[model samples]
Target: MTATGGAAEAGQGPDQDPIRRSYDTVAQEYADRIGDELAGKPLDRALLTALLEQLTDPRAPVADLGCGPGHVTGWLADHGARAVGIDLSPAMVELARRDHPSAEFREGDLRGLPAVDGEFGGAVALYSLIHLPPAEHRAVLTEVARTLRPGAPLLLAFHRGSEARHLTDWWGHQVDVTFHFLDPDAVTADLTAAGFTLRAHLDRAPYPHEAETDRSYLLAVRS
Candidate 1:
């Protein structure tokens, strides 16, 4: 959870550049190849169900931040939550909109979303924050706190590890991005500092048939 590499210059941070550029570059290929991934992930499906369970009503607006190809958003809709997908990559947004016509998708940074204060009852970030350096995580959580109504829940999924990873290429395409593996204690501390009441934290080794690396999920409520 320690800061690594370099920090952004004053008045700017991680969301402004690298993440957007890299994801936008990979959006199409990612969508075409991995859009239906949730169909194969049972644990993720159960966690998402639990995410909606915290909401008092199924119709409450629940956002999928860094929604990528929108499969999770669509799943939320299918299961009950009024879901809208948001991402920092325009290309990803476009693919999400096209691929998952049942749900809505928008492109925007997590540091400053397009939603008004207290506009949503729930939200989820599925493996989204891994691209963010820890220096930028709290501010993003602050924004999440602002966007969610009091007592609303948010679920986050990320890789679990001590070191950071740099990817120079993905899906045979040249791209620049950094993915951070996080410690649960550090993530909980950031969520608590951002005005969230932590509800649960869980981690497990990756599914045998899925991608490598351990995974973590945190469920928190806006205070």
Candidate 2:
């Protein structure tokens, strides 16, 4: 069955390495495809603009977690903010560095980011958390909170629906990758449990490839 996000499921499995390996191998293609679309009209940019409007200072440090090809990182840098991009795939990090020379793209896993504690004023993870098990969402959110100063803003973008179904990552080329879709309400609960206050929750129009029924976004602030 096609993957779907839903209310807390009872028997979800832990994140495995096969998915990471698949992504690493296809990182270049993934970066290329997503980069082209995002560069044209970035979802992260639109959300970030809204987020920055609420910030007291837009120049503060902001991290683009799971930043593929550094599209949003480049946007943040261009807008005069201290922006850094982090991704688990070395190929993606390489491409992001080459394409966005001005922005910093580091190779790291989001499950355990290497960002300095409380150094960032904001953070974002566009479609990056979907692979995590539902149970880990709170831990990941806590990790995100740890890297930001108190009251730092954070934006997490993910596809939404109603159950935990696993499917191959279908960007073509026959790679075997999988991800868990997140339910918006459960994600919000995870964020709140991680010490963040709900700021905004939006179900956006699906981007080109995203099935119209499964696209969504959530923006939150650290309390």
Candidate 3:
């Protein structure tokens, strides 16, 4: 994958600016911890299965944005989608490539994707958007939309929240990392602003082993 500077750098405020840096610092540990969990977990598999059901065609190219360790990307490839994984952290990209040899993994920023316009048939921004505040959501969605063909499927997953919250968990790498959560209606609004129509949404309590949190999902289509 090609690399470049000047990635839009739009739609970020003080509270959210530190998040990227935190993820960069913890990229490796984050991948090591969550990679295998997401790969074989029944909860994640169920979500992917549901997502695949909404896909319009069997053979379609997919972009797995913020793909950590290529678990979901590899799954999509196995299911007949030409999948490519992209992430902001180079270490995460490296780990993803090492773990999932069949799929393509690239170090790239979501705010400014290197993908050609209308290149992907679908995109998955799973659990990645939670890092940004609500204000930046639409801009990121618009960027994702630009890479997808009209009517292409896009699945986004995140924890449901009534307001933005800052967090510091030691599970990943060193520096403190913060995540922002949004409610379902807010997510739908952002998707609509990005020229997508909500197809289906699932709100389920995470499994027993999962941490206690409000989880929500949305499967939308480009318009």
Candidate 4:
């Protein structure tokens, strides 16, 4: 999180940009802190299991978009899915590869994923979409839809609200990043616009030891 100017001001796109660098700077500490988060989150694990159960081919490839440290991807792999973790930070990708050798890991941007069209049987983006601006949500969801087979499921999770929070200091690192809290209805509309049929929409208060914001999860099928 060296002081790189705002990505927009720097004329750099989202790929390999400030957000990526910010995450890269704190990747190790972030991984060490949150890597095993699912263990404490029963609802998250349940939702993920639900997503896996919806997959038409249990062994088919499942992309973990914005995967950090590969924990979720590893869980998917352990649960009988061909899980692949993808992230924008090379550092995160490296750590993921190191930690989860059984599952594949790669560097990729959500706006333009590194995969063939309709290649994924399912996808998950837990707490990942909050990094993108709301204006870009629809386009990103469309890109995600493009990578999934017909009727493939997507499980998306995000902070639920209508506010943006910028962090300049994180775990003693000077990072530049913004987390956008999103409305479930708006995201549902974006999913519909991106050719997804909504299956479920859920929201819950934060569990103790979690961030204070409420969280939203949407399960949808690519149509």
Best by lDDT: 4
> Against the true structure, whose TM-score is highest?
4
Tens-place lDDT digits, model 4, residues 105-199: 87777777888999899999887777777888898889889999998999988888999889899889988788778899999999999999999
- lDDT per residue as tens, model 2, 156-217: 77767665545554566454544566689999999999999988887867666645556667
Q: Mind giving the per-residue lDDT tens digits that candidate 3 earns over 91-192?
A: 566777888888998766667787899888888777777656577788888888999888888887787886554556555444544456668898899899
Q: TM-scores of all models?
A: 0.90, 0.84, 0.84, 0.93
Off by over 4 Å in 3: 1-21, 39-43, 53-57
**Candidate 3, pairs of clashing residues:** none
lDDT of each: 0.75, 0.68, 0.69, 0.81
TM-score of 4: 0.93
| Model 2 CA lDDT for position 166 | 54
- RMSD (Å) per prediction: 4.5, 5.0, 4.7, 4.1
Compared with the true structure, the alpha-carbon lDDT of candidate 4 equals 0.81
Per-residue error (Å), model 3, residue 18: 4.5
